[model samples]
Target: MPDPTFAGRTVVVTGAGTGIGRATALAFAGQGATTVVVCGRRKERLEEVAAEHPAIVPVVADVATATGARALADEVRARGEGLDVLVHNAGVFRFSPLAALAPDTVREVLDTNLLGPLLVTGELLPALLARRGNIVLVSSRAGHNPGPGSSVYAASKAGVHSLTRSWAAELAVHGVRVNAVAPGYVRTEAYRANGMTDRQVEGLFDAVAGSVPLGRVADTDDITPWITRLADPAASLVTGQVITVDGGMDTGAGQTDQDA
Candidate 1:
Protein backbone atom coordinates (compact mmCIF):
# COMPACT_ATOMS: atom_id res chain seq x y z
CA MET A 1 0.00 0.00 0.00
CA PRO A 2 1.11 3.54 -0.67
CA ASP A 3 1.90 5.93 2.17
CA PRO A 4 -0.81 8.30 3.35
CA THR A 5 1.30 11.42 3.61
CA PHE A 6 -1.12 13.26 1.36
CA ALA A 7 -4.28 11.48 2.42
CA GLY A 8 -6.50 14.56 2.61
CA ARG A 9 -4.65 17.02 0.39
CA THR A 10 -5.70 18.32 -3.01
CA VAL A 11 -2.95 18.59 -5.61
CA VAL A 12 -2.91 20.05 -9.14
CA VAL A 13 -0.54 18.77 -11.83
CA THR A 14 -0.53 20.40 -15.26
CA GLY A 15 0.50 18.42 -18.41
CA ALA A 16 -0.51 15.28 -16.57
CA GLY A 17 -1.03 13.31 -19.78
CA THR A 18 2.49 11.94 -20.13
CA GLY A 19 6.17 11.89 -19.22
CA ILE A 20 7.15 13.59 -15.98
CA GLY A 21 3.68 14.99 -15.55
CA ARG A 22 2.02 11.57 -15.72
CA ALA A 23 4.51 10.08 -13.30
CA THR A 24 3.95 12.97 -10.88
CA ALA A 25 0.16 12.53 -10.96
CA LEU A 26 0.49 8.85 -10.22
CA ALA A 27 2.89 9.53 -7.38
CA PHE A 28 0.46 11.89 -5.71
CA ALA A 29 -2.46 9.51 -6.27
CA GLY A 30 -0.46 6.62 -4.86
CA GLN A 31 0.12 8.70 -1.74
CA GLY A 32 -3.67 8.86 -1.27
CA ALA A 33 -4.18 12.48 -2.11
CA THR A 34 -7.95 12.97 -2.00
CA THR A 35 -8.12 14.98 -5.22
CA VAL A 36 -5.43 14.95 -7.91
CA VAL A 37 -6.37 17.46 -10.58
CA VAL A 38 -4.64 16.30 -13.79
CA CYS A 39 -4.64 18.94 -16.52
CA GLY A 40 -3.57 18.33 -20.12
CA ARG A 41 -4.36 19.25 -23.71
CA ARG A 42 -5.29 15.73 -24.73
CA LYS A 43 -8.66 14.53 -23.49
CA GLU A 44 -8.12 10.87 -24.30
CA ARG A 45 -4.82 10.56 -22.49
CA LEU A 46 -6.05 12.53 -19.50
CA GLU A 47 -9.15 10.34 -19.30
CA GLU A 48 -7.01 7.23 -19.55
CA VAL A 49 -4.98 8.28 -16.54
CA ALA A 50 -8.07 9.36 -14.65
CA ALA A 51 -9.66 6.01 -15.37
CA GLU A 52 -6.70 4.19 -13.87
CA HIS A 53 -7.10 6.17 -10.64
CA PRO A 54 -10.49 7.48 -9.69
CA ALA A 55 -8.84 10.02 -7.45
CA ILE A 56 -7.36 11.70 -10.56
CA VAL A 57 -9.58 14.48 -11.84
CA PRO A 58 -8.73 15.03 -15.52
CA VAL A 59 -9.19 18.52 -16.93
CA VAL A 60 -8.58 18.99 -20.66
CA ALA A 61 -7.41 22.56 -21.13
CA ASP A 62 -4.54 24.30 -22.92
CA VAL A 63 -2.85 25.85 -19.91
CA ALA A 64 -0.64 27.96 -22.21
CA THR A 65 -3.26 30.66 -22.41
CA ALA A 66 -4.75 33.04 -19.84
CA THR A 67 -8.29 31.81 -20.51
CA GLY A 68 -7.21 28.23 -20.04
CA ALA A 69 -5.52 28.97 -16.74
CA ARG A 70 -8.55 30.79 -15.42
CA ALA A 71 -10.81 27.93 -16.51
CA LEU A 72 -8.64 25.38 -14.75
CA ALA A 73 -8.51 27.46 -11.56
CA ASP A 74 -12.26 27.93 -11.68
CA GLU A 75 -12.87 24.23 -12.11
CA VAL A 76 -10.59 23.36 -9.22
CA ARG A 77 -12.20 25.98 -6.98
CA ALA A 78 -15.61 24.57 -7.81
CA ARG A 79 -14.68 21.01 -6.98
CA GLY A 80 -12.21 21.28 -4.12
CA GLU A 81 -12.57 23.81 -1.32
CA GLY A 82 -8.99 24.91 -2.08
CA LEU A 83 -5.77 23.65 -3.60
CA ASP A 84 -2.82 22.62 -1.42
CA VAL A 85 -0.23 21.84 -4.10
CA LEU A 86 0.27 23.31 -7.56
CA VAL A 87 2.69 21.59 -9.97
CA HIS A 88 3.33 23.71 -13.05
CA ASN A 89 4.64 20.96 -15.31
CA ALA A 90 3.42 22.00 -18.76
CA GLY A 91 6.31 22.89 -21.08
CA VAL A 92 7.43 22.57 -24.71
CA PHE A 93 10.90 22.16 -26.21
CA ARG A 94 11.99 23.17 -29.69
CA PHE A 95 15.29 23.18 -31.53
CA SER A 96 16.56 26.08 -33.67
CA PRO A 97 19.87 27.75 -34.29
CA LEU A 98 20.12 31.41 -33.25
CA ALA A 99 20.36 32.68 -36.83
CA ALA A 100 17.45 30.56 -38.02
CA LEU A 101 15.14 31.13 -35.01
CA ALA A 102 11.90 32.83 -35.98
CA PRO A 103 10.27 35.51 -33.87
CA ASP A 104 6.95 33.61 -33.77
CA THR A 105 8.66 30.41 -32.69
CA VAL A 106 10.38 32.15 -29.78
CA ARG A 107 7.13 33.74 -28.70
CA GLU A 108 5.31 30.42 -28.80
CA VAL A 109 7.99 28.73 -26.79
CA LEU A 110 8.05 31.50 -24.18
CA ASP A 111 4.27 31.64 -24.00
CA THR A 112 3.99 27.94 -23.34
CA ASN A 113 7.00 27.43 -21.12
CA LEU A 114 7.31 30.69 -19.15
CA LEU A 115 4.08 32.65 -19.40
CA GLY A 116 1.84 29.63 -18.96
CA PRO A 117 3.16 28.92 -15.49
CA LEU A 118 2.95 32.58 -14.55
CA LEU A 119 -0.68 32.80 -15.61
CA VAL A 120 -1.62 29.56 -13.87
CA THR A 121 0.18 30.59 -10.69
CA GLY A 122 -1.42 34.00 -10.74
CA GLU A 123 -4.90 32.58 -11.20
CA LEU A 124 -4.38 30.05 -8.41
CA LEU A 125 -2.46 32.29 -6.02
CA PRO A 126 -5.46 33.21 -3.88
CA ALA A 127 -6.45 29.59 -3.31
CA LEU A 128 -2.87 28.52 -2.75
CA LEU A 129 -2.27 31.34 -0.26
CA ALA A 130 -5.35 30.37 1.70
CA ARG A 131 -4.01 26.84 2.04
CA ARG A 132 -0.33 27.77 2.51
CA GLY A 133 0.43 25.57 -0.47
CA ASN A 134 3.58 24.76 -2.41
CA ILE A 135 4.42 25.28 -6.12
CA VAL A 136 6.87 23.09 -8.04
CA LEU A 137 8.01 24.38 -11.42
CA VAL A 138 9.54 21.69 -13.68
CA SER A 139 12.50 23.36 -15.32
CA SER A 140 15.37 21.72 -17.23
CA ARG A 141 19.14 21.32 -16.97
CA ALA A 142 19.26 23.19 -20.29
CA GLY A 143 18.32 26.33 -18.37
CA HIS A 144 21.63 26.42 -16.52
CA ASN A 145 23.68 24.92 -19.37
CA PRO A 146 22.56 25.81 -22.87
CA GLY A 147 23.34 23.82 -26.00
CA PRO A 148 23.53 24.88 -29.67
CA GLY A 149 19.98 24.23 -30.89
CA SER A 150 17.78 24.95 -27.88
CA SER A 151 18.18 28.66 -27.26
CA VAL A 152 14.49 29.42 -26.77
CA TYR A 153 13.82 26.40 -24.61
CA ALA A 154 16.78 27.23 -22.41
CA ALA A 155 15.70 30.84 -22.04
CA SER A 156 12.18 29.78 -21.05
CA LYS A 157 13.42 27.41 -18.39
CA ALA A 158 15.83 30.00 -17.05
CA GLY A 159 12.81 32.24 -16.68
CA VAL A 160 11.10 29.50 -14.69
CA HIS A 161 14.06 29.20 -12.34
CA SER A 162 14.04 32.95 -11.83
CA LEU A 163 10.29 32.92 -11.23
CA THR A 164 10.72 30.15 -8.68
CA ARG A 165 13.11 32.27 -6.63
CA SER A 166 11.10 35.47 -7.05
CA TRP A 167 7.81 33.84 -6.08
CA ALA A 168 9.33 31.95 -3.20
CA ALA A 169 10.40 35.29 -1.76
CA GLU A 170 7.12 36.98 -2.64
CA LEU A 171 4.92 34.24 -1.19
CA ALA A 172 6.92 33.42 1.93
CA VAL A 173 4.92 35.93 3.94
CA HIS A 174 1.78 33.96 3.08
CA GLY A 175 3.47 30.70 4.04
CA VAL A 176 3.55 29.44 0.45
CA ARG A 177 6.75 27.77 -0.72
CA VAL A 178 7.96 27.83 -4.35
CA ASN A 179 10.80 25.85 -5.91
CA ALA A 180 11.98 24.41 -9.25
CA VAL A 181 13.26 21.00 -10.35
CA ALA A 182 15.62 20.87 -13.34
CA PRO A 183 15.64 17.45 -14.99
CA GLY A 184 18.20 16.17 -17.46
CA TYR A 185 17.25 14.07 -20.46
CA VAL A 186 14.56 11.56 -19.51
CA ARG A 187 13.13 8.93 -21.82
CA THR A 188 9.71 10.01 -22.98
CA GLU A 189 7.43 9.11 -25.90
CA ALA A 190 7.41 12.72 -26.97
CA TYR A 191 10.95 12.36 -28.30
CA ARG A 192 10.06 9.46 -30.53
CA ALA A 193 6.90 11.16 -31.69
CA ASN A 194 8.92 14.18 -32.62
CA GLY A 195 10.84 12.14 -35.23
CA MET A 196 13.89 11.15 -33.23
CA THR A 197 15.16 7.80 -34.44
CA ASP A 198 16.02 5.26 -31.76
CA ARG A 199 19.71 5.37 -32.57
CA GLN A 200 19.71 9.17 -32.55
CA VAL A 201 17.89 9.29 -29.21
CA GLU A 202 20.26 6.71 -27.75
CA GLY A 203 23.21 8.65 -29.07
CA LEU A 204 21.90 11.82 -27.43
CA PHE A 205 21.46 9.97 -24.16
CA ASP A 206 24.93 8.48 -24.38
CA ALA A 207 26.45 11.90 -25.00
CA VAL A 208 24.54 13.36 -22.03
CA ALA A 209 25.50 10.43 -19.79
CA GLY A 210 29.18 10.84 -20.69
CA SER A 211 28.95 14.49 -19.62
CA VAL A 212 27.48 13.67 -16.20
CA PRO A 213 29.52 12.34 -13.30
CA LEU A 214 26.82 9.76 -12.58
CA GLY A 215 26.97 8.65 -16.27
CA ARG A 216 23.23 8.09 -16.77
CA VAL A 217 19.95 9.73 -17.57
CA ALA A 218 17.07 9.96 -15.10
CA ASP A 219 13.84 8.04 -15.36
CA THR A 220 10.53 9.82 -14.91
CA ASP A 221 9.77 7.66 -11.88
CA ASP A 222 13.09 8.60 -10.33
CA ILE A 223 12.17 12.31 -10.17
CA THR A 224 8.55 11.98 -9.07
CA PRO A 225 9.25 11.01 -5.47
CA TRP A 226 11.44 14.04 -4.86
CA ILE A 227 8.67 16.26 -6.22
CA THR A 228 6.18 14.63 -3.88
CA ARG A 229 8.51 15.11 -0.93
CA LEU A 230 9.09 18.75 -1.75
CA ALA A 231 5.35 19.34 -1.87
CA ASP A 232 4.91 17.85 1.57
CA PRO A 233 4.41 20.07 4.59
CA ALA A 234 7.52 18.56 6.18
CA ALA A 235 9.58 20.46 3.57
CA SER A 236 8.07 23.76 4.66
CA LEU A 237 11.44 25.36 5.28
CA VAL A 238 12.73 24.55 1.76
CA THR A 239 11.88 27.31 -0.68
CA GLY A 240 13.45 29.46 -3.44
CA GLN A 241 15.78 26.61 -4.34
CA VAL A 242 16.48 25.25 -7.83
CA ILE A 243 16.97 21.56 -7.17
CA THR A 244 18.82 20.08 -10.17
CA VAL A 245 17.83 16.44 -10.48
CA ASP A 246 20.08 16.10 -13.52
CA GLY A 247 22.63 13.46 -12.50
CA GLY A 248 25.31 16.14 -12.03
CA MET A 249 25.03 17.27 -15.65
CA ASP A 250 25.10 20.91 -14.65
CA THR A 251 28.37 20.60 -12.74
CA GLY A 252 31.17 22.49 -14.49
CA ALA A 253 33.92 19.90 -14.00
CA GLY A 254 32.63 17.40 -16.56
CA GLN A 255 31.91 20.03 -19.21
CA THR A 256 35.23 21.72 -18.59
CA ASP A 257 37.02 18.47 -19.49
CA GLN A 258 34.86 18.10 -22.63
CA ASP A 259 35.59 21.66 -23.78
CA ALA A 260 39.28 21.21 -23.09
Candidate 2:
Protein backbone atom coordinates (compact mmCIF):
# COMPACT_ATOMS: atom_id res chain seq x y z
CA MET A 1 0.00 0.00 0.00
CA PRO A 2 2.77 2.45 -0.82
CA ASP A 3 1.06 5.53 -2.17
CA PRO A 4 3.29 7.93 -4.07
CA THR A 5 0.82 10.78 -4.02
CA PHE A 6 2.99 12.63 -1.50
CA ALA A 7 6.33 11.37 -2.76
CA GLY A 8 7.89 14.75 -3.30
CA ARG A 9 5.52 16.78 -1.16
CA THR A 10 6.43 18.63 2.03
CA VAL A 11 4.20 18.15 5.11
CA VAL A 12 4.32 19.79 8.51
CA VAL A 13 2.85 18.13 11.57
CA THR A 14 2.70 20.13 14.79
CA GLY A 15 2.79 18.53 18.27
CA ALA A 16 4.53 15.59 16.68
CA GLY A 17 6.69 14.64 19.64
CA THR A 18 4.41 11.85 20.67
CA GLY A 19 0.92 10.34 20.76
CA ILE A 20 -1.28 10.95 17.74
CA GLY A 21 1.12 13.51 16.33
CA ARG A 22 3.99 11.04 16.20
CA ALA A 23 1.75 8.44 14.64
CA THR A 24 0.63 10.90 11.97
CA ALA A 25 4.16 11.95 11.06
CA LEU A 26 5.12 8.34 10.50
CA ALA A 27 1.98 7.67 8.49
CA PHE A 28 2.71 10.48 6.05
CA ALA A 29 6.31 9.39 5.71
CA GLY A 30 5.22 5.84 5.05
CA GLN A 31 2.93 7.07 2.33
CA GLY A 32 5.90 8.63 0.46
CA ALA A 33 6.15 12.15 1.76
CA THR A 34 9.72 13.40 1.28
CA THR A 35 9.98 16.09 3.94
CA VAL A 36 7.94 15.66 7.11
CA VAL A 37 8.70 18.37 9.64
CA VAL A 38 7.72 17.42 13.19
CA CYS A 39 7.23 20.54 15.29
CA GLY A 40 6.91 20.49 19.06
CA ARG A 41 8.34 21.98 22.28
CA ARG A 42 10.35 18.91 23.28
CA LYS A 43 13.56 18.45 21.34
CA GLU A 44 14.25 15.13 23.01
CA ARG A 45 10.90 13.63 22.01
CA LEU A 46 11.25 14.98 18.48
CA GLU A 47 14.70 13.43 18.29
CA GLU A 48 13.23 10.10 19.23
CA VAL A 49 10.66 10.41 16.45
CA ALA A 50 13.43 11.27 13.98
CA ALA A 51 15.28 8.12 14.99
CA GLU A 52 12.23 6.13 14.02
CA HIS A 53 12.08 7.59 10.52
CA PRO A 54 14.63 9.44 8.44
CA ALA A 55 11.96 11.48 6.69
CA ILE A 56 10.98 12.97 10.05
CA VAL A 57 12.81 16.26 10.51
CA PRO A 58 12.26 17.47 14.06
CA VAL A 59 11.68 21.20 14.57
CA VAL A 60 11.38 22.33 18.16
CA ALA A 61 8.73 24.99 18.36
CA ASP A 62 5.90 25.83 20.74
CA VAL A 63 2.79 26.33 18.64
CA ALA A 64 0.97 27.87 21.63
CA THR A 65 2.78 31.20 21.16
CA ALA A 66 2.65 33.55 18.18
CA THR A 67 6.42 33.83 17.99
CA GLY A 68 6.91 30.09 18.01
CA ALA A 69 4.29 29.45 15.34
CA ARG A 70 5.79 32.08 13.08
CA ALA A 71 9.26 30.74 13.66
CA LEU A 72 8.09 27.28 12.63
CA ALA A 73 6.57 28.62 9.43
CA ASP A 74 9.81 30.43 8.69
CA GLU A 75 11.72 27.22 9.22
CA VAL A 76 9.52 25.51 6.64
CA ARG A 77 10.00 28.40 4.22
CA ALA A 78 13.73 28.06 4.72
CA ARG A 79 13.50 24.56 3.35
CA GLY A 80 12.41 26.11 0.06
CA GLU A 81 9.60 23.64 -0.51
CA GLY A 82 6.01 24.69 -0.76
CA LEU A 83 3.86 23.12 1.93
CA ASP A 84 1.77 20.19 0.77
CA VAL A 85 -0.11 19.40 3.95
CA LEU A 86 -0.26 21.05 7.37
CA VAL A 87 -1.59 18.95 10.24
CA HIS A 88 -2.45 20.88 13.38
CA ASN A 89 -2.16 18.16 16.00
CA ALA A 90 -0.46 19.93 18.86
CA GLY A 91 -2.81 20.25 21.88
CA VAL A 92 -3.00 20.41 25.67
CA PHE A 93 -5.57 18.79 27.95
CA ARG A 94 -6.29 19.97 31.48
CA PHE A 95 -9.36 19.10 33.51
CA SER A 96 -10.73 21.30 36.26
CA PRO A 97 -14.19 22.42 37.30
CA LEU A 98 -15.04 25.98 36.24
CA ALA A 99 -15.00 27.08 39.88
CA ALA A 100 -11.42 25.89 40.46
CA LEU A 101 -10.03 26.90 37.07
CA ALA A 102 -7.57 29.78 37.04
CA PRO A 103 -7.79 32.52 34.42
CA ASP A 104 -4.20 31.84 33.31
CA THR A 105 -4.93 28.14 32.90
CA VAL A 106 -7.99 28.89 30.78
CA ARG A 107 -5.97 31.21 28.55
CA GLU A 108 -3.19 28.68 28.16
CA VAL A 109 -5.57 25.90 27.16
CA LEU A 110 -7.37 28.08 24.63
CA ASP A 111 -4.12 29.45 23.24
CA THR A 112 -2.60 26.01 22.78
CA ASN A 113 -5.61 24.13 21.46
CA LEU A 114 -7.36 26.81 19.41
CA LEU A 115 -5.27 29.90 18.61
CA GLY A 116 -2.08 27.94 17.94
CA PRO A 117 -3.58 26.10 14.98
CA LEU A 118 -5.03 29.29 13.57
CA LEU A 119 -1.74 31.14 13.83
CA VAL A 120 0.35 28.35 12.32
CA THR A 121 -2.11 27.80 9.49
CA GLY A 122 -2.27 31.50 8.75
CA GLU A 123 1.50 31.72 8.62
CA LEU A 124 1.69 28.78 6.24
CA LEU A 125 -1.21 29.81 4.01
CA PRO A 126 1.01 31.16 1.25
CA ALA A 127 2.99 27.95 1.03
CA LEU A 128 -0.15 25.83 1.04
CA LEU A 129 -1.71 27.89 -1.68
CA ALA A 130 1.35 27.44 -3.87
CA ARG A 131 0.92 23.70 -3.58
CA ARG A 132 -2.86 23.52 -3.37
CA GLY A 133 -2.40 21.71 -0.05
CA ASN A 134 -5.02 20.78 2.50
CA ILE A 135 -5.20 21.08 6.29
CA VAL A 136 -6.04 18.40 8.85
CA LEU A 137 -6.87 19.55 12.36
CA VAL A 138 -6.81 17.16 15.30
CA SER A 139 -9.86 17.91 17.41
CA SER A 140 -11.46 16.01 20.32
CA ARG A 141 -14.80 14.46 21.18
CA ALA A 142 -15.11 16.77 24.19
CA GLY A 143 -15.63 19.62 21.76
CA HIS A 144 -19.00 18.20 20.83
CA ASN A 145 -19.83 16.24 23.99
CA PRO A 146 -18.83 18.52 26.83
CA GLY A 147 -19.08 16.82 30.21
CA PRO A 148 -18.01 17.63 33.78
CA GLY A 149 -14.54 19.11 34.52
CA SER A 150 -13.85 19.71 30.82
CA SER A 151 -15.05 23.24 30.28
CA VAL A 152 -11.82 24.85 29.07
CA TYR A 153 -10.64 21.96 26.92
CA ALA A 154 -14.07 21.49 25.40
CA ALA A 155 -14.38 25.17 24.56
CA SER A 156 -11.00 25.18 22.78
CA LYS A 157 -11.84 22.16 20.65
CA ALA A 158 -15.25 23.61 19.83
CA GLY A 159 -13.47 26.66 18.49
CA VAL A 160 -11.31 24.36 16.37
CA HIS A 161 -14.42 22.83 14.80
CA SER A 162 -15.67 26.27 13.89
CA LEU A 163 -12.27 27.21 12.48
CA THR A 164 -12.30 24.08 10.34
CA ARG A 165 -15.48 25.24 8.69
CA SER A 166 -14.32 28.82 8.30
CA TRP A 167 -10.97 27.86 6.80
CA ALA A 168 -12.57 25.32 4.49
CA ALA A 169 -14.82 27.96 2.97
CA GLU A 170 -12.03 30.53 2.68
CA LEU A 171 -9.55 28.09 1.13
CA ALA A 172 -11.86 26.31 -1.32
CA VAL A 173 -11.16 28.69 -4.20
CA HIS A 174 -7.43 28.26 -3.52
CA GLY A 175 -7.89 24.48 -3.75
CA VAL A 176 -7.02 23.91 -0.10
CA ARG A 177 -9.37 21.69 1.89
CA VAL A 178 -9.77 21.99 5.66
CA ASN A 179 -11.12 19.25 7.89
CA ALA A 180 -10.88 17.86 11.45
CA VAL A 181 -10.83 14.46 13.11
CA ALA A 182 -12.41 14.34 16.55
CA PRO A 183 -11.25 11.44 18.67
CA GLY A 184 -12.47 10.28 22.11
CA TYR A 185 -10.39 8.80 24.92
CA VAL A 186 -7.43 7.55 22.91
CA ARG A 187 -4.70 5.93 25.02
CA THR A 188 -1.95 8.55 25.26
CA GLU A 189 0.48 10.13 27.72
CA ALA A 190 -1.87 13.10 28.15
CA TYR A 191 -4.09 10.99 30.34
CA ARG A 192 -1.20 10.06 32.64
CA ALA A 193 -0.02 13.68 32.79
CA ASN A 194 -3.55 14.69 33.81
CA GLY A 195 -3.05 12.92 37.17
CA MET A 196 -4.55 9.54 36.44
CA THR A 197 -2.77 6.49 37.76
CA ASP A 198 -2.32 3.57 35.37
CA ARG A 199 -4.97 1.62 37.24
CA GLN A 200 -7.31 4.55 37.26
CA VAL A 201 -6.68 5.07 33.56
CA GLU A 202 -7.49 1.45 32.85
CA GLY A 203 -10.64 1.70 34.94
CA LEU A 204 -11.66 4.86 33.14
CA PHE A 205 -11.17 3.18 29.77
CA ASP A 206 -13.20 0.17 30.90
CA ALA A 207 -15.96 2.40 32.15
CA VAL A 208 -15.99 4.42 28.93
CA ALA A 209 -15.85 1.27 26.86
CA GLY A 210 -18.82 -0.09 28.76
CA SER A 211 -20.75 3.09 28.20
CA VAL A 212 -19.74 3.64 24.55
CA PRO A 213 -21.36 1.46 21.96
CA LEU A 214 -17.92 0.18 20.94
CA GLY A 215 -16.29 -2.26 23.37
CA ARG A 216 -12.86 -0.59 23.48
CA VAL A 217 -11.01 2.67 23.45
CA ALA A 218 -8.77 3.82 20.56
CA ASP A 219 -5.04 3.80 19.94
CA THR A 220 -2.97 6.43 18.15
CA ASP A 221 -2.64 4.14 15.14
CA ASP A 222 -6.41 3.81 14.97
CA ILE A 223 -6.65 7.56 14.28
CA THR A 224 -3.64 8.17 12.02
CA PRO A 225 -5.12 6.70 8.85
CA TRP A 226 -8.24 8.82 8.87
CA ILE A 227 -6.28 12.04 9.41
CA THR A 228 -3.80 11.07 6.68
CA ARG A 229 -6.65 10.14 4.36
CA LEU A 230 -8.14 13.60 4.62
CA ALA A 231 -4.81 15.12 3.66
CA ASP A 232 -4.36 12.65 0.84
CA PRO A 233 -4.88 13.89 -2.70
CA ALA A 234 -7.52 11.20 -3.15
CA ALA A 235 -9.91 13.14 -0.91
CA SER A 236 -9.88 16.19 -3.14
CA LEU A 237 -13.58 16.97 -2.81
CA VAL A 238 -13.72 16.54 0.99
CA THR A 239 -13.79 19.74 3.02
CA GLY A 240 -15.51 21.50 5.91
CA GLN A 241 -16.15 18.17 7.59
CA VAL A 242 -15.34 17.03 11.11
CA ILE A 243 -14.97 13.28 10.98
CA THR A 244 -15.58 11.66 14.38
CA VAL A 245 -13.51 8.54 15.12
CA ASP A 246 -14.48 7.85 18.72
CA GLY A 247 -15.31 4.16 18.48
CA GLY A 248 -18.97 5.09 18.55
CA MET A 249 -18.65 7.05 21.80
CA ASP A 250 -20.26 10.23 20.48
CA THR A 251 -23.07 8.40 18.80
CA GLY A 252 -24.42 5.11 20.12
CA ALA A 253 -24.41 3.72 16.60
CA GLY A 254 -22.54 0.49 17.28
CA GLN A 255 -23.31 -2.63 19.26
CA THR A 256 -22.78 -2.18 23.00
CA ASP A 257 -20.42 -4.36 25.04
CA GLN A 258 -23.47 -5.96 26.67
CA ASP A 259 -24.64 -7.06 23.28
CA ALA A 260 -21.36 -8.84 22.76
Which candidate comes out best when scored by TM-score? Answer: 2
Per-prediction TM-score, please? 0.94, 0.95
Those runs of model 2 whose alpha carbons end farther than 4 Å from true positions after fitting are 253-260
lDDT of 2 by residue, 87-177 (tens): 9999988877878999988988899999899889889999999999999999997887777787889889999999999999999999999
Listed per model in order, the count of residue pairs whose N, CA or C atoms clash below 3 Å is 0, 0
* Global Cα RMSD, each model: 2.4, 3.1
Query: What would the TM-score be for candidate 1 when compared with the true structure?
Result: 0.94
Per-residue lDDT tens digits for candidate 1, residues 1-260, read 67898998999999999989999999999998999998988999999899889899998888889888988898888985688999999888776678999998898889989999989998998889888989999998788877777889889998999999999999999999998888877877656754779888787777767877887778898788778988988998999988888777666646522110
lDDT of each: 0.85, 0.88
lDDT of 1 at 35: 92
